[model samples]
Target: MAARPIGLRWKLSAAIALVSALVALALSLLVHNAARASMLDSSRDAQDERLEFALRAYDSGGQLVFDARLDDPTLPEPLRRAVVKGKRATYVEERGDGPPLVWAASQVGDQVMSLNGRFADRDRALRRMDQVLRVGSVLVVLSGTALGILIGGQLSRRLRKAAVAARELAGGATEVRVQEAIGRPARDETDELARAVDALADALRKRLEAERRVTADIAHELRTPVTGLVTAAELLPPGRPTELVRNRAQLLRTLIEDVLEVARLDGAAERADEQEVALGEFVRRRVERLDPEAAVEVTREARVRTDPRRLERILGNLLSNARRHGSPPIEVTVQGAVLRIRDHGPGFPQTLLSDGPSRFRTGTTDRARGHGLGLTIAAGQARVLGARLSFRNAQGGGAEAIVWLPAQAETDDGTPGPGSPGPA
Candidate 1:
């Protein structure tokens, strides 16, 4: 037969109740015994005082006299006999006109009383105390058991919430939260466990985001150059000269370089060398280098701590994307550790605006020209550098990208001046 599994709460509560019952039982027994002994001693003391009073009365009057009445109403019915020097003495009292009474008296003036009534009374009282103690012990045990069960139930409920939260997290519900209504504080084990589960879910979400971005970036980088190469090849004359073929090949090589750069950015293959770069200067330089004829403008002065090469790649990709998909006249501005890039292009598609960033989203642009990985890579790069990136359509018909860098590299004046370097 299989053994039944006991729950922790029940086991703990049972153990506590058992211990409490044992202690209460022992204490009740001790109290009952003490009470019984005290009652017996009191009965004997009252009998002795009565005998002494009778002896004094008989000695003082010199007439064999005794009081047949007891001072205590609780005294039991018993024969009082007095014998002097082994001879029993007869006594007559005015209080009782019935038959004479005799008792054996000891040499030391001790009198012996024999009766079942006193013993019976003591026995009855002891029995009553025993019943009361038994009832009280039972009440104590039950109350303790109830208290233990209540505490155990509360703890079990909290632990169950944590377990359910863990299961939900494992099932890919990153937003699941454990209920904290059990009164356990945040520093307690249950709360700590809930926090750990939440952290795991957040980590999984970030990892998934990174993976999706990488995949989209790869497809976008590959499609652009391949399409260009195919188009150039088809346009070549049937009997093209070697010079024409060489020019087309050079174009293919440039396209390959561009593709390789995008690939490197996605793969994080660039080396990290720390540098202090002025954000304003870097943005202006990148805009000039990439698209001098595109009517690009720069504003604001900010400094950043980063690896120069990686930062350039991040900005370069953003600029290239805007030039390809946007309507031109790009605006780049930096303030403090924040950089804003806006293009006077057809703003993001309604779907993308609503959904935010998604995998392989082209944002209302032609598929052949824009594969939608550029923003994804830029976002990933920003994340790698501990920055937050956000996208939104400008009030005027255009799209705007904002990157907020880490606080450590910002100027004390809350502005990034020209002459700061790239991300480290």
Candidate 2:
């Protein structure tokens, strides 16, 4: 089983959210660092002022010296070492149970001064700023997610609409076109896609129309000559030599008819004049007309509403192909909505089974005599009547053609199945 694919909307939304979160986090870190540095600078400046005051008030052993309680000062070891080396030293200490303290030590010509400043007020402000920044970061992430959903949803809908139009157009809906709005100053990728698909559809429609017209005109022109040839062949002497010629003339006539029929179908000139049809009787009559020796199995009697003329044409063409290309012992089966015809010949060639019939291109190399129009005509007729016609090879080796028709009524007994109109 395949896993369901994730929608583009969600994917885009996640990407936007991720980027936004990273931006927010980086901004918070920058602000946090800046605030911490500012607090430290303020503490250092206050300590410098206090150190000057302590120096002015100092008088130690007749040598003026800044006095400061440094015996228990919470100064870092680096700051203490710097002070002992007669260098100015400053450090901030954070008290676990109380408040933070800023300490400074300086020595001037054998006089040492040490000072401490209270940093509780600045620490409280920093903590408040930290809280605000944290809250702002969360809000920023949430806002980014919501914005992503809105943008992603719109994009997803636009892309999905274009996809639907293309799919419908591909399914033979000639009028199905992707409509892109004009006069927009800004056209996005989706708009470009819609325009491209619409252009392609228009070109395809014109090309197919031209091809159909050429086929119809050629077929119409050849019909008169073909009819004359058939008539001339009929008047010929009844000799074995003329037999092949007559048969060839008839084959030429069939090809012309097939071409004309396909042209009509392509031009949408055929309509289903559906009527009640008996499955068993229809198959029996068609088979009898083609070959009397072929076997037919009627598992159930069915009354189906379908275009009788089209159905007849479809069956006639199938039987004709079977006779020409298949061996003896052809069998027909009619059950409910299914009609399967199989021939005990080399199952349909691989090419025929895969690609169906192409006009003028014989379906197989072995049976190259026919023009390959019979199955093509049958397929067209089947489509006109809203039925499915498919070809496959039988299990034991033989060509099989299955026509699935809508069953209006069916029964296992030999009685006439209920006569009702099925979907045309």
Candidate 3:
């Protein structure tokens, strides 16, 4: 079988979280880039203003008077040369131990007075801003992940309810309803989906009910004529004509019986009468009853609590199917709560595996006759017994049908009566 799809909640949560993280990362980069440029411009402007102030205070100081802050020896040589030639100059100078300084020089009379200041405070401010932005970016992404998980969980819960309702409908629930999401109410796509599913289920139920009614009426109407035909065929002379007539009547009767049984199964008229069944002995007895030549191989001892009648019906149909559609020394093995019935024959058709058996498929050819209802009836009976029946093509070449029973019941004699309670 193809792998099951992942749930909607987790997919939604992951998508939202990824988008949030990308958005936060982009915003952080944009803010950090703009801040970097702005910080550099502000530092340059402040240095220029400081240089202008120092030059104004030292006017006409032919002896090269300078303020204590601007009198640093780390000024650039080009700035000093420009002052000596009675010109103005500005340059940036860096020292080994501190932040870069902005230096300006001008000549007053024949002496040179230079202005310079370190940009240490501006660099410190920019570094602090960078640290803050980094911390904020991390927090944003973390918060987004948590929010995604919360929203995803809510979406998953609503989607799962719709899924459950659909499953109930598939399992023959005549009146399945999609439940509205719990908590805060809102009209959204999820709500619309729930409405659509309920509508589809209602439509399906009506049509199926009509089809079932038609089938039941036809089966009931045929019973009287089939009884008469069977009696008339029995009274006829012992010849081929009588045998053929009798066979036709028998086939028709079996079809009618199958239809009625299916109707009962659908109407919930069947209930399991759970009883302890010894796996080894039960397998041997059932195989002997159905096909005397078929091989019975019980490798493990086990006891299961289930309806034995349903279990027998299920096994009988499977064996009949094997004989009709397959060449077999049909092999049946009981291992724990699992039973395997395999036949050496052409394996299951692709259509049968994909879509299951149709009740009306046996109406045509010899090979398609009674084999049509075999697997279908087995599946229905298995469900009645709360067991799982699966079909597969075995290795080499053959068809395999496996029945997985319910939990085993622990008992002393392994043959507890129907009403005698056993340990579950």
Candidate 4:
């Protein structure tokens, strides 16, 4: 059979209880010994006083000897034996007779006299003391054990709470918390453990969020080209197959190229040329290249240190997302080191706003139109470029995303020049 494992709480409690019991037992024994010694000394003193009075009576002679009673009720039976055998002393005790007292003979002023009752009643008294000590020690040890167990149990309970919380945390339950008793401050080991667990959970949550964003972006970017290729292939006529095939083949090539661009943005074996670029000029050039029908706006000029290709992909994806999700009249703003992209469409869906963005979460409900990769790719690129990106509904009924780039220097031409590239 396998041996059962003992818990930490039980181990600690048992250790405390055992130590307490041992100490209590040792103390009880020491006290018992001291009390016994004191009682024995008092018994001996009383016996000696009785013997002294008897000696005086015997020495008085005549009527004094007849009046003197050797067996005094004040002295126990075992102590009375001190008078017998005269000059010889013996240690003997009987039940209910107390302990034996020491007796001896000594000469004073050329007279012979008997000395009796020195250490009287000690044996019986000692026996009674031993019994009492044994009983008292038992009681004291029992009481101490009980008290120790109670204290140890309470301590174990608190420690167990922390242990349970630790286990839950290890198992990935980041939100698990210890329940505090009434009027108790939440500043114990359990609370500390809970805090550490919460920190880990928060970090894990952030990492998962980043990963979901990457996955969604990849899916979204792939969906657009895939859809285009599928549509082009479907449109090919069965008759005059060669001509239809040629058009389909051209559409496939365009789809591949677009997909490759998105892939590069996703860090698919392509490295960015890290360089300082003027933010105002970069944004202007990108806007100029966009579909003329899409009304674009630029509000401020700010320089940011970033990779040129990465920055372009970031801008391109944002623009693509805006075009796909929003109306034609798009507004773009750059103020300080922040960039704002706003769309006049129906704004963000309530679900998206609440859930935030994920891999392949597109604005349009059209399942066949595009995969929701644009925002994911843009967000990923922004992260790689050491920038922050966020999306929300504008106050005046439109979807807006704000991007905060690293601070940059203003050029002589009023355009922003790169200061330093921040960490990815």
In terms of lDDT, which candidate is strongest? 2
Q: If scored against the real structure, what TM-score would every candidate get?
A: 0.43, 0.82, 0.78, 0.42
Relative to the true structure, candidate 2 reaches a TM of 0.82
User: Which of candidates 3 and 4 is the stronger one according to TM-score?
Assistant: 3
Error of 1 at 279 (Å): 1.1
lDDT tens digits by residue: candidate 1, 342-398? 789887677866765553567654666654666666766665665667778899788
Best by TM-score: 2
Q: Would you list the rank order by lDDT, best first?
A: 2, 3, 1, 4
lDDT of 4 at 312: 73
Q: Write the per-residue lDDT of candidate 2 for residues 313-383, one digit (tens) a residue.
A: 88888877887888878888887667888888877877877877777766668555788778888888887
Runs in model 4 deviating more than 4 A are 1-270, 291-300, 350-356, 407-424
Regions of model 2 farther than 4 Å from truth? 2-6, 47-68, 71-74, 81-89, 93-101, 108-135, 180-186, 349-356, 406-424
Question: Please, what are the lDDT tens digits per residue for candidate 3 over residues 1-424?
Answer: 9999977666776787788778877887888779756765666566656656666665545222235234346556777776677666666665677666666666655555566666677768767877887788778767777787788777777777778877877877656677443334457777777778778877877787777788888888988899888898899999998899999898888888888777667665578998887877998998898899899987666777788888898888888888877787789987667788899988877667676666656423565456366677788887778777878888988888888876754433564322222222
Q: Flag the better candidate by TM-score, 1 or 2.
A: 2
Looking at model 4, residue 282 earns an lDDT score of 75
